[model samples]
Target: MKKLMMTATALALGAGMAAADTIRMGTEGAYPPYNFINDSGEVDGFERELGDELCKRAELTCEWVTNDWDSIIPNLVSGNYDTIIAGMTINDERDEVIDFTQNYTMPDPSAYLALSKDVDVDSGVVTAQTGTIQAAFVADSGATLVEFATPEETVAAVRNGEADAVLADKSYLVPIAEEDDSLVLLDREENINMGIGMGIRESDTELREKFDAAITSMKEDGSLNELIKKWDVGATFD
Candidate 1:
């Protein structure tokens, strides 16, 4: 789940989970292997299953909601949902506006997918989803960065020859690379952020702690790593 644009600075959410017993878990519902909408029109993938388990462990009644990646944070702070179980990275920029549970997985390596093995990652046109860390990396790497609104578009840019490569999480791109003979992952990778965690509002300390405890339990019990192995979605905990 490559998430958030960081433009949502001022959030208007008041108290956290005040009126309901059910907590709304917000997700992008598009990033596959991590998250996506299944044919049944339901949220599915590693995060979906992981979120359900965490909610169960926390003894919280949770319902899922879908949001676009660009506005996920703003909507979370605006009270549209109670928590973002959306494979969001925990970082200083994001922590400024919302709290996060302990990381449930290790940092995912950002990998490059190109049309050819000979493409110069440093000098060629590269595409990335707007607001992602991969996009930020491209902006500073001397490559001409092409920003797309969706992850699908970034990959499409490479296929259409609009970009020489696309940078994204390896887990997300690995499936595509295997499915398409035209795409190949470059030899190098970029390790980004503190790893994936559930995002909650700043005021939701109680909720945060609850999920944190649940995550701790999962990590310690070794189930988290098992899930990671099952989905092949990024690195696992020790």
Candidate 2:
């Protein structure tokens, strides 16, 4: 993409901008209400707004860069970007690889969908968004597993009978299922992920603290919860 090529070139040229001075915010611009590529092909969404505010509060110059979800963390570790503002879940497994600021958002509410109740919730052909625990669950559940790049595609898989069911977050699926008569939100639910946080490398303790303090400020001032409500991000700060 134009953004990707431009970012690579800037990094290669050493742009004379110290990496520590101008932070690059990386995201998987595919998940909506979280991060997504807009109609203008620019990254835009809740995470985008949140990241910008955090940068402003931290008094840091920031640039936005989008990457595939599958490679977002690895790329961050590889020094392709300075910070990950993607909606990554904070967990023991990932924390071992990279440090995380305190959670900015709560656990994502996950759900399963099917065409009808007859579609087996278990042991049936299952479709899930790729690079997720849901996909892994399906693969390990003895069901025929199908993976899709986006959450929307996973729902489509069920509609077209490509798979008997789909496992995804409720926030993304609820809007779609409510509008379509064919989509069924199954009773089954999951909360596999913990809270969401900004991913930082182990050595970037100063950078991490800045964002953490900024997040604390927002939480205390109630701005973060307001955004959570406006974006329908479910469960604001207590």
Candidate 3:
């Protein structure tokens, strides 16, 4: 009888813990306007703010953690974090590994930018950040693709003339090109549409559903639109 009572108490305790209503989220904290460390050494960005709002709407406490971009997905799958609020693009390749919430950001194209006027990006040699849709595009297009660890490295390759052009998200590259006159965005006839979404562990369909519902509600109520306008996010949703 004592053993049975103890087991019942443990089960009740476990249930209470599970119903605590806190969601821990992960982000790269290096991707600007999405998640990044500001001058104050604090994480602040569109995704961060949006995640906080979503948690509020869902009546859950949110804890944000900084993670490296390359390892974010792996850590998420390992249960190190409950959800990934990073500006992760939802691609078919990634879908094989993890499930994603309904896309919160609209799809935008990736483009090529170069620092050298004489370099012919049209000749089909380019560098892209590894594991991105842009890298896949370059590979499929038969370009001599050089993979870089980060966007900064890809941009530096272009500046140093080591690469003919750097392919990245147009929204990010456009602001960078505008800031640095040495780089020019190539006028391409084709652009790749990539939708960014929040990631969750494959088994966490319940959490993903909550996120999707919250995002859909925000979108319907104009809160999401207000956030986009406040952050000046380059893309818009239909």
Candidate 4:
């Protein structure tokens, strides 16, 4: 009888240990200012820091994994990650697949970048990553649209004159344009804000609630705002 009790206690202890809190996070780790690999090859960016902070607040161990932007969602659905901390814009289309926390970061309007004197945002054809908001804009405006695999490729296309304009996140383009005098910023006056939130599996309501609480605490304490300013992330959380 004593042996049976001991065995049951051991099993319960093991189960408790297995259920100890740990969170695996996914990010592109290539989108600068949001999340990217640093020169040291470690993930670094506003989103990365925010994830770390939130995990700390929730008393959970965090393990970050890098995945391609296009596959981030699919991986989350497959249980490859407990949550996605990448700079994913929260939209109705995405909500159909996964549940998201409240908006932690807001999106800025997609902007155009082109080589000086060679491209026109209003007249020439513009290209963006296929299935992106910028691509939707191109389709609606009847502009010639080109597709690329990555943001880097789209920017390269503009530089090489393969595409007249590249529409992407303004925060990404502004820094690149400032560094390269050959590039010019277009559509500075447009403001399109898209809310960005953490992605979780459709059934992970418990985890989602924890993350949402952490985010709400961060925003209330001004930590989120400070991180946004420190990183120069294009959009505001408020």
Best by TM-score: 1
Candidate 4 Cα errors over 4 Å, as ranges:
1-20, 188-190, 235-238
Residues 88-115 of candidate 1 have per-residue lDDT tens digits of: 8778878889888888879889999998
**1-238 per-residue lDDT for model 3 (tens digits):** 0111112112221211243345678987866767788889878999989998887665567788887776778888876877888778898888999888898887767778987555666565699877777888888785789998677888988888788898887766777889999898888723665677888877777567667778888888778888887776656665
The residue-by-residue lDDT of candidate 4 on 42-116, one tens digit each, is: 899989899998877766678889988777788888878778888787888889999899988766667788876
lDDT of each: 0.85, 0.80, 0.75, 0.76
Cα displacement (angstroms), candidate 4, residue 171, comes to 1.0
- The number of the candidate with the highest lDDT is 1
Tens-digit lDDT string for candidate 2 (92-201): 87889888999999787778888897777677899987877778767888789999887778888899889998987676677778899888888888878688899998
Which scores greater on lDDT, model 1 or model 4? 1
Question: What lDDT score goes with residue 229 in model 1?
Answer: 97
Candidate 1: pairs in clash: none
| Candidate 3 segments exceeding 4 Å error | 1-21, 122-124
Per-residue lDDT value at 131 in model 2: 73
Error of 2 at 154 (Å): 1.9
TM-score of 3: 0.86
Scanning candidate 4 in windows of ten residues, the lowest lDDT window is 1-10
